[model samples]
Target: MAKRLLFIFMVFILGDIYFFQAFTTVFHTPFLHNAYWCIDLSLLIGVATLIFFQRQGKDIQRQAGDLITFFLIVFIPKLVALPILLTEDLLRMARGFPPRNIYLSEFVLICAALIVLVIAFGLTRGRHYYRVRKEILSFPDLPDAFDGFKITQISDIHSGSLSDVDGVRKGIALANAQNSDLLLFTGDLVNNKAAEMEAWISDFTLLKAPFGKFSVLGNHDYGDYTRWDNAELKASNLDRLKEIHQEMGFKLLLNESIKIQNKGASIALIGVENWGKGGFHQYGDLGKATSALPAESFKILMSHDPSHWDRVTLTHDQHVHLTLAGHTHGMQFGIELFGFKWSPIQYFYEQWAGLYQKQGKYLYVNRGFGYHGLKGRIGVWPEITVITLKKSVS
Candidate 1:
């Protein structure tokens, strides 16, 4: 880890040095040049400080997130402009050391400036810019009574990182406005501590549905990321988090299944604990959750990570008609416009955002309800997903 970080630091420094030439060319003022170096030095020092504190075993999760945000805001624009500046330099070298291309340097600066404005908006307004994504899923085996069952799902609250009460209230209010038949929260309710959710209990409790609200834990709920004085303390923290879920009017499901009945017909709702691939803990038992159900039961499974859908749920003996998850948070940054969508998180999670189907089973990965490591969202806004299940004609 240390070696990788060192390599990254060296790359950052080299990139800054190369990009600074363009900065100097675009602006001839001595004051601006001094200001540029000052910001660069400050960021480098900040990185060093974070590394030192981390090695000392201090819990700097929040600080680390802030630093990452700063790095993106400062470096992404430079990265975008690097290729253009490098091309200009190569052309000049081929032409026998001619004068620098002032026009190209100016253009690169303009592009970088525009990117800064976009990043600024993401840091300020994008964090709370909630978007509602609706999908209509058709299942042939869906019960007639559940032909139009609407489900509202929000995931990865990470309440510890939330600071704006009004912003949170807006999201909760929006979720309630959907007026779905069932409400589900695929979790990360807090960031490693139960106390993070104390203030938001009332806001979340307002999320209503005609059927009921149910939830399943995510990887972050286990309190494994942070240090605890003892095992009992960590256990107690998780216990308290479970109680918070109940207080928020959500039935916390831990590897359990329940039947939701309407008009004398029913569909199964199964929720398992946080089970993820790539070193994530395997606490969920799919067989135990569906032990009492018949093979042909119309089931909607709630698992926190979408990887579960591919790794286990798809191949399980009993088929799951639909699965809802929200762990990737769409990497809190990406471009989604004009029917095109892309995010860094996609490489890590096959089913990162939106709807995915395989072998006739459906999985919808929510972007997330709250921010985490980056402190703000860019193109991938916070999400409130509403899925309508319809009975498909055979």
Candidate 2:
């Protein structure tokens, strides 16, 4: 970790130097000069802060420090490179271009200013805004009793990262206001410890649905990432987390299936433990969970990571009509506009967010209800997804 940090620090310094040099060659204005210097100074100070925190210890303070340094380490270089690359594109368009230094400088400065505004907005308003996304899905196998059934799915609360109690309460209120028939939490109720959820248990417990609330374990729930005193303690922490879900009135499903009956019609709600692809935990057993269920039952699955959908659920013997998952969190950054959605995580996760259909099987990956490492969102805002199941018209 120390070596990695040092490498990042060196990269940051070099990138800052390159940006400063490039900007100075273009514009010699006193204001532009001072601003670039200030940015360089800030980058140096950020590196120093990271070293201090990392050397001192790893705690909430260190996590917060990492978040601060990450933004600079990741974005500062991109901000610098963007303009240089833009100038390269411009030069390619014309032969014997006289190197439009002034225009390049102005454009870079404008872009820098825009970045500041965007960061400020993302830190302030973006983290607090919870966008409620409603999706209506039609399935030929959906039972008539479940037709028009409204289900609300929220994932990756990461309660350990939340600092605003009122903001969370408001999000909870927004979810309850939907009046969905079933409430489902795909996973990651807490970051690492069950204690992180103590404060918000009351608020989350208020989430009501006639059919009931169901949830499954997420990668973070097992306390695998955190160092524990002993194996028993880690197991105890996971046990307590599962207990907390029950307290929140959620049926914590672990390789289990339950029947939801209404008006003599029935559907299976299967919950599997975290089963991710490549490096993530693979504790969920789809075969074991569905072993006793009737083969023809209309099934809805809750698996925390969407990778499972592609890896196993799609080709499973039993037809799972719809699967709910949330893990990528859309990398908490991306562009989502009308009919256009793209995130870097997409390259890593096929079903990162929103709904996807393949060979009649549907997967809906929630954007998550809370922030994670960065502690703030950009274009990919926190989400509360409401899905209505509609019976296909035939």
Candidate 3:
């Protein structure tokens, strides 16, 4: 752990040294230089302090979140400037002389400034900038009576991280405005403790849909990240979280399936506990969830992590036409514009954000309904997904 911290410190120092060149070249004022170094040094100290507190197991959730947000605000712009300055240095070395471009430093500064503006907005307003993403999934086997059924999905609420009650109220109001036939929450209702959701219970209860609201657990819902006095305490916290779901009018599905029927036609909604790839816990049982369902049932599944779709759901004997998920949170950062989407989380989970289809199965991974560790969202804003189910005609 010490070695890892040292390595991280060295990397930050190196990056600071490399990025300082652009600042020096672009700004002639000594005061500006002093301010820049002061911020950097303070961030370095904060990082060290945060690590120490974390190692000591102190409750530094808010501090850690703030430090991460500040560090990224400082680090990302400098990171953007690195390649620009490096390109100029490479040209100088290749020619064995000073680079001809006099405006390169200024250009790098401008780019960094723009990035700072974006990051600032993300920290201030983007955390609650809920975007409603709509998708119309057509399935040949869909029940005709259920065609045009609208489903609203919001995942990774992380109520513990939410500070702006009005922001959350607006987001919930927006979800209600969608008038989705069914509402589904895909987990992470709190960061760690069930008590974190106490304040927002009323706000969430406002989310309405004609077909009723349902949910499934995510990895964070298990209280796995925090220390408990005993096994029973941790278990009790989880039990309370489940009750909280009910208090908010959500029918929490552990590893079960229920039918949503209309006009004598029905579709099966199967929900499982958090089942993720890599080191995440595997509490979900796909077989148990779908065990009694007919093979021909048009199934819509609610699983927390998108990886479950790739690792388990796709090949399961029971065919699930659509799966809704939200664990990745698109890393709460990334670029998604012009019909192209990319987030660092994609490297870990193939179906990180938005909609993905494979072998006739559809999965929509919500970017998340709330922010967590970083306390803000970058390009990947919080999402409320509305999916309309349509029957495909031959």
Candidate 4:
């Protein structure tokens, strides 16, 4: 068992190395020029701490202290990240975008990912729950048809890393404050197993949307990253996670459709299994999923991958009007300050975060509510998107 765990750990660490090398090759220049350098320092601290953790005795308390520090290491960079995202001045005044080929922006995304690796290392070492950061996302102009659409969106929760339901109550409170019209969870509900949510099953029930609550799957939800000797067991775990969703007042939408109707005005919510350019998520079949929607009316897709908007969705399909995604997690890093948007993850995801429109189609890539791999949220604090369906006013 230990050997398997170690092998998994090595695989992840090596993947990080490859990511860094590939990123540098593309950008070929120093990152961000100024603020980007901080991540470089964070990386150095990460390397030194990793070696320290490996050498430490397996004593639980000593290990616990290390876990806390691991959280800190992951958490601090986000303070830098927050300034870049929320502060109006920082983003607007910031100069330069990532160079196209080898874009330095990607490096920023890669560095953001490193924080997760560090946290996952802690979890692999039996560490969990360093801290849970609470974030509120209030969107502009919620449609009158859906006024007070207090939708609670929890994305990239990565439940396996959660030691306990630390911020669960606070998060619920935040969600309730908006008097949410609906609650939409954008995927990554569990890190790996269905059992992980056991500790906090009751907590999620606290979140109730007047209309209803819904959930989708994330990359980690499939448990593909782990080596499962029995495919049946893996499949069973997924089924169980669905059961958990049902238990928590959520309707798990897997390549299915639902109707949100109020005062006779209705919008169709179409959910397909995760779909990405590569085989990241393969179950999304728009043809089959949208079969429920009539030839007309608006349809919003809850697909985990943003690429689906470009690769498969934006056709004259007419059935799909909006795509809501969250897998990129804004690379969980970057600055949106000073009226300038900068994040390395953007190169891979043109619609990495916030509202985007193209070819008359629309997409809202959420920043996510819960932090993944890492313990803290930086520039792109987890978001709860409130989308208002506006008339073209044409």
Candidate 5:
């Protein structure tokens, strides 16, 4: 792991050096050009520190995420500006015009301005811009008692990645303010160990719903990504994570079915362990989870990964009315504007975020309450999904 991180740090350094060299040639001032190198060196040191802490078995997700944000803020503008500037210079040559140094200087200044703006936004607004996405879903077979049942679902609260505890507390308070009938946490309460959530337990316990609070394990909850001292230690971590859910007043469902009642009417809610496509572990047993429920009963599934919905749940003999998941986190970045929503993860996972319906079955993939890897969200703001279930009058 250390070697891999070192390789990545080297690659980033080399890439930045290549890009900064272009600026050096454009400026033609030796001392001013050296200033750029100083900045690059400082950023490289930041990356090195992140890697060093990671190697020393420390949780530095927030620090690492900030470094990534800084890298993007600096590099992306140059990547775009340089291409456009070069293309314009080529067009000028074709028109019998000589390449002008002034034009290059202007382009550089514009690129610098853009970099400043990006950094300002990422640091000030990117992390705290939480959105409450309200979605209304209708089902034909939904019972009358559940017609107006409101569910607020949150997922992927990677507490270890959080740098601002106060901001996170506000997000949790927002979820509580919704006052929905039921609160469902799909998965990923922490990044790795159960201890990651120790500090935030009191904050999250404030999240309450009239019906009840229910949760399931996310891929990160198992601590599979980290190496432990022994097998027993790893097992103990997972067991403690389960107990943490109970302490938070949440019923942890592990390949089981529970009945939720309202106005003398009930629906079967099934939760399976993490079952994801690709390299993600497939510990979830859909058959075992729904085995005890009556075939004719209305059912809802709480799964961490959305890939399991179409691949396993829909194909199963027992039909599930709805599946709630949140593994994708919309890749923590994307463009959702002008009536269009897209993320690179879409190419890999068909159901990456938001709502999807096929042949009357529904899937709602929450954008996630917290974040991972890159730390701060870009275009894809952090989300708290409020879904209202309505009986179809049609």
Candidate 6:
């Protein structure tokens, strides 16, 4: 199983690089005008899927051919559309119609395509956010201690989504408006460097939580994806990110738990390093973090990936009453309106958005505070989670 999993991971990584290059190459080219406007995302996804099947020891040559065909279909026109999207400088270089308007109208078309790309990219990114939120659990077993607790959770802000400083400020402002008793961030504060959030630290500082503000690292926080070329610099990046969290008045939780007390009522909250059960980050020691808590205590686990619920929380002997996670962004495409919610990412994830309760355990996966791929949100807007925990009153 592990070997198969690794192979699939390799296929996914390779397929991603191949398709991304194919698309970028087309986008930067001046030719390949034979593409169409009636394109759908399924073509590319199908190709990606074929790669998965090939890795699973199904068929490779057929899948590879399909991928090539899909590549040709998307690659050519994307390049064809690029010049049309650009200004006359590069526009004249391509063979578009009506000279300047060719470029202008094509540019408009590209912008429209961008809107679709945002939806698609956001949807893809949103896959990780699929966590069935926990039910407002009632711990009447005699906690008489902490009731009516409100914990605010947000994740995957991917701060790079903003163009200027206020964009980051605005995202924080929205999250702060929730007035949560305990405000928690699950990780991915900045897309790259710790200093990238330098200008926005004060904004995070504006978040007011009576109990306290706490956070953990996400996959991006470790600086693992870059050309680090050195272990020291990468380690420093993670360390500085921790410092930034502390500067924002957040108690950085790393493979550890802290008991928060209110009105003489105390509950344990634990957070760990980035843990992804999927093809992502390392799983934090859920058992080790919770080892210090009383076996009977009402515990809330704060690992970044909701998949941890399935991996550890659900079947564990130490009943974790609630788990808060937010790596998935709800694929940034689903519609949640007027009592209805749906997204394409749901097919890949069992709990894509909202609250979910299974086998006496709960996980709340926040949709996140900012966009990742494109700056726009369609059906799934940037989220502000306001969870009020009250007695079941049952």
Best candidate, TM-score: 1
Worst 10 residues of 4 by lDDT: 126-135
Q: Estimate each model's TM-score.
A: 0.93, 0.87, 0.93, 0.65, 0.84, 0.67
lDDT against the true structure, per candidate, is: 0.91, 0.84, 0.89, 0.64, 0.84, 0.67
lDDT of 6 by residue, 1-394 (tens): 5776576456544444333333443354434222322243566577678778766766344345345444433443344444444444354466653434434444445654675564454344432322223335565542665667777787887765445555556556666666678988988887766766777777778888988999988877887545565889888987888899999999999888999887777788999888775577675887788888888777888877777778777887788877877766676655687879887556556776677899767778777776554344446766667676665543
Give candidate 3 regions above 4 Å deviation.
1-15, 28-35, 99-102
| Each model's total of backbone clashes | 0, 0, 0, 22, 0, 13
Candidate scoring better on TM-score of 1 and 3: 1
Model 2 per-residue lDDT tens digits across residues 345-365:
887787898989998888999
Quick one: best lDDT, which candidate? 1
Candidate 4: global Cα-lDDT? 0.64
User: What is the TM-score (0 to 1) of candidate 6?
Assistant: 0.67
lDDT by residue for model 3 (1-394), tens? 4676576567666668867776777777999999999998898799789889889987787888888888888878777776666777787898895633548777877888899899889987999999989999898888889989999999999998989989999999999999999999999999999999999998899999989999999999999988888999999999999999999999999899999999999999999999998889999999999999999999999999888999999999988889999999899888889988887576667888988999989999999999899888999999999999999985
Listed per candidate, the RMSD to the true structure in angstroms reads 2.2, 3.9, 2.5, 12.4, 4.1, 11.9
Q: Which has the better lDDT: candidate 1, or candidate 6?
A: 1
Full candidate order by TM-score, most accurate first: 1, 3, 2, 5, 6, 4
**Least lDDT summed over 10 consecutive residues: which range in candidate 2?**
57-66
- What TM-score quantifies how close candidate 5 is to the native fold? 0.84
How accurate locally is residue 360 in candidate 3, as Cα lDDT from 0 to 100? 89
